[model samples]
Every structure is written in C-alpha cells, then in structure tokens.
Target: MISGPSENPELWAFLESLHRGEILCGTVTAIERFGVFVALDDGPDHPVFRGVGVITIPELSWQRIETAFDVVQVGQHVSAEFLQFDTWNLEARLSLRATQPDPFQAFADRTAAGQELHGRVTKLVPFGVFVQVTDGIEGLVHLRELTSTSVEKPSAVVQAGDEVTVVGTEIDRERRRLILSRRQGPTAH
Candidate 1:
C-alpha cells in the first residue's frame, strides 16, 4: 500500500504496523555521547539516518551512566520497546531499560540497615557524595558521614571515582532514600 518505489517498502510497511509498546531487537550500529543508534532486523533502512531506532541516555538503562558507552557497545544486540515514532527524523524512539527488570527490588531483598557495603563515589554535592552500591542503586553519604573530622565540603574527604565502605543507616523504600554512614571509619580506597 506504500506509494512509490523511491520510498523504502520494507520500512513503510513496518512503520505502518508498528505500535507503542511493541518489542523489537536490533544491533547497536552506533554509540554517540547523547544516544545509541540501532539498526532493527525487521525494518528497512532509514531514509535519512544511519539507524532507524534511537535510545536516548535515560532510555539506555535504569542506572545512572556517565556516557552512552557505559551501557552498550557497537555491534551489541539489544531488545527494546518501541516508545514512539520520531516523525521529524522518521526514526523509531526506543527504550532499552523497559526490557530489563528493576534492580532495586533485588538490592532491597538482600540488603538491610546497618549492613556495610563497598561502592564507588559517583557524584559530589554540597551536602554529600552519591555512591553507587549496585548498578542502578545510589545512596547518599552525607557530609557528616564523610569523615570523623568536621568538614566544610564533601570534596575535602572524597572525590568521584573513589572507593569507600559505608554502613546503611536508613533505607526508606517509599521515599527511595538510602542514607549511608562512615561511622566505622569508611576505608578501602
């Protein structure tokens, strides 16, 4: 039912049949700083783009990533949901995280308050440092927890990429807040 030979028959037909929430698989053709590009197996080549499907940073994974390469690599095969059709670019907007299970449930099931865990410092804020205990779960290590000595800034005690051991002081599932402490001498750089 597509109009002309100049138009991609396979792509036109596939787009007509595509709908939100449909799951699709493709090879990661490219990985840019902003997003990941995928060439779908069941679709035709994009008329103007290198790949027909795109997964933005937030859609790449549930975990916080410093870059697109952190979650996927070129030639990696991924299955994702068809979030929408990008009419402007004539591409498919995809979400890779939608296909994966939530990692928080597993973290909560195994960990409890007072449990000491080792994680890498991901970010430093005015009040505290954010640490990634697992892939997607981050806990806040408040300024008071940075060290025994009174500190004016989190940078004085720790920096991003530093490894530190912390004790879970509080875990509020409803608030999704995890408070950690260094009361036991947060060592293990």
Candidate 2:
C-alpha cells in the first residue's frame, strides 16, 4: 500500500513526543501486505517514540518487499519495536545499525592546516579534483588552487594514488567538511 502520510489522532500525538526522542508505545493500528502500521498510544504506558527511527524491511519479521501484501495483516498490534522518530516526516526510521559507531563522526576533526594526510586523486571535475583521504573521507582541491597554470582537467596531471598531501583550508565541524588545497605544498614555489 502507498504510505502517503497516514492519518490518525493517537499516531500524531505519539509522534510529537517521539520527535523529542521520547519512547512512546505505538499500537499496530493497521497492517498491510507491505508492513505494519503502528499508532502510538497517547497513554503513558506505551511510551516508545523518542528518536528518529523506522522499521526497514529486514528489521521486520519477513522480507519487506516494496510491493508485497503477504507480509503483514491488518489490525495486528504486534508490539513492534521502535528505532527513532522524526516530527518533520511524522515517522521513525528503524535501523539495525543504530548502536554501531557513526561513520560521519570521524569527520568531526578537520582542523590543523599543517596536519598532512596522504591522499589519492579520485576525480577531475571542472571545479576541482576530488581526493580521498581515507576510505569514507574525501576532500576537494579547487582547480584555481591546484596550480597557477591553466589547468583544464585535474586528471591532466593528477591521477589515482598520486601521493598528494592534503592541506586543510577550512574546517566545518558541523557539516563535517574540510576544504583542502594542494597549491601550498611543502616544496611548492
């Protein structure tokens, strides 16, 4: 069934407290062949919604196919587990990797201009060249910042594993972004 913004009084109030990361119990109001639809009971006993979460396919009992009606039945209040709650979306996104370490958390540190990191050029975009510092971390060196020459394509000179040193230009702790540059290398003119 199309989950086009469900409508229910108890579900709305249940989602409010959930946006604040409050655990509110949600009663399975309606279950379709796709998945179970839960309505958080306004009562204090069923407090489950408190963070942003959802009940993805694997998290559910059976394989959650996009178009399957054989997974769940209607009006089956099956004490479903809670993962997270978001007020904007009026829903929660469940995940099995919730307890796992945040992948973006490692990007919190982007300061120290002199802190050199050996990276490889991944792409040669018109704007600049994309460098991969680590497996998941990447920094960009603007085209104008690579060299004062008429560098048209970044790949013209730089390629994969060129052993480029990343010099931090700007640090965004919140955005988890680091503006990097290769123009001011240690041995540059």
Candidate 3:
C-alpha cells in the first residue's frame, strides 16, 4: 500500500506490479547508442534510474546508422516508452517507441529557417560523421562544415551530438538531392 505523498508509493506499487513490463511516457536523462536513460512520472522530484538500450548503427534513424555520431545526444529531451522495470534496482528499460512523428520524421519534414538537433556520434570517418535526427532521419556533417567551411577534418570540430545546427544548403546532387551543409559558423582559425 502507498504510505504517503512523501513515499510516492503509487510509483512503488506500479514498479512492484509491472513485474517485467514498462511504464511509458518518461523523460530522457542520458542517451547512448545502446539505449537511453529515462525518468518516469509520478516519482519523487529526483531522477529515476533508467538503463541504456542500444540503437545499434543500423537501428539509428529511419534508414541505417552508418556512424554512432549520427544519432541522438545527451541533455536533449525525448519521449520514450518504459519497456521493462527492474524492481530490485529500480531501473527502467526505455524505448524510443513512444512519440508520434518520432522527432526524426519531424526533422525530415522541416523546411524552415533552421533546426536544433541533439544527436549521438554513430561513427567518425575522415569525410565527416552521421547524426540520427530523431528516430528515422540521419544528417551528414561534411568535413568543411565541421567548423565554418574552413575545416578539413570533421573530427576536429565535433565528435557526435555536439548539438550542431544544420542549415539548408543549396541542392548539390540532383540524383540524390543532396543538401550541402556546414557547422553553425565562425571557426577559431
């Protein structure tokens, strides 16, 4: 039974009863390729323990994640489902299968001034890296744009969800309809 508001037994009871299930609609505290950290609702003002689940390279975005650098990042807010609950440790297993439009889809549908995305580094190659924007879209940050069009190596500027801005560049490839982009702007050198 729930003791009092101080105890927040409703949450305790839910965890105890859910057994090997989830408690959806939570906030993401941290993100990694494997999975994400979530804090559920109806709990104390403190952050609850949510374990990491891998999105794998391919699992990133609607297409395939070529680089870990292409997907989600830390400090960004995300909606996820509670896939599993660990009673012993009070940790929750989360899933990106929580919101509609999924973030990735929304990004793809964007044609506005600019966008702010928080992604994780799926991979870091010479050219640049891939960033999974949401759950179904990945954007490329080429070498030049790594820092103000003067960059030769993408790695020198950003690692992953360094949370960079992707401005719409003129269509470079008609075949693929490629969008040329550079990091936000103003390189140190």
Best by TM-score: 1
Taking the tens digit of each residue's C-alpha lDDT, what string does model 2 give over 1-189? 212235445555654444432344444454444344555354322234332234444545322246323444434433344566544555754432233343445554443655666788877788888787776667788877777576887777677667787776765666656677776757442
Per-residue alpha-carbon lDDT of model 1 for 1-189, expressed as tens digits? 224334666665676678999999999998888898999988888776678899999899877788998889999999999998765566789999989876766687789898989899999999999998887799999898788888999989988999889988888876667888876533522
Off by over 4 Å in 3: 1-62, 65-106, 113-116, 170-189
Q: Give the total clashing residue pairs for model 2.
A: 24
Q: What tens-digit string does per-residue lDDT give for candidate 3 at 62-173? A: 4444454455665545554445655444454444544333444354456333444455555567987765544544566667755655666666777755665555443223
> Over 4 Å off in model 2, which ranges?
1-7, 22-90, 93-111
Question: Worst lDDT window (10 residues) for model 2?
Answer: 44-53
lDDT of each: 0.84, 0.54, 0.49
The candidate scoring highest on lDDT is 1
**In candidate 1, which residue ranges exceed 4 Å CA deviation?**
1-13, 113-123, 144-150, 158-165, 169-177, 183-189
Quote each prediction's TM-score: 0.69, 0.54, 0.35
Query: What TM-score, to 2 decimals, does candidate 1 have?
Result: 0.69
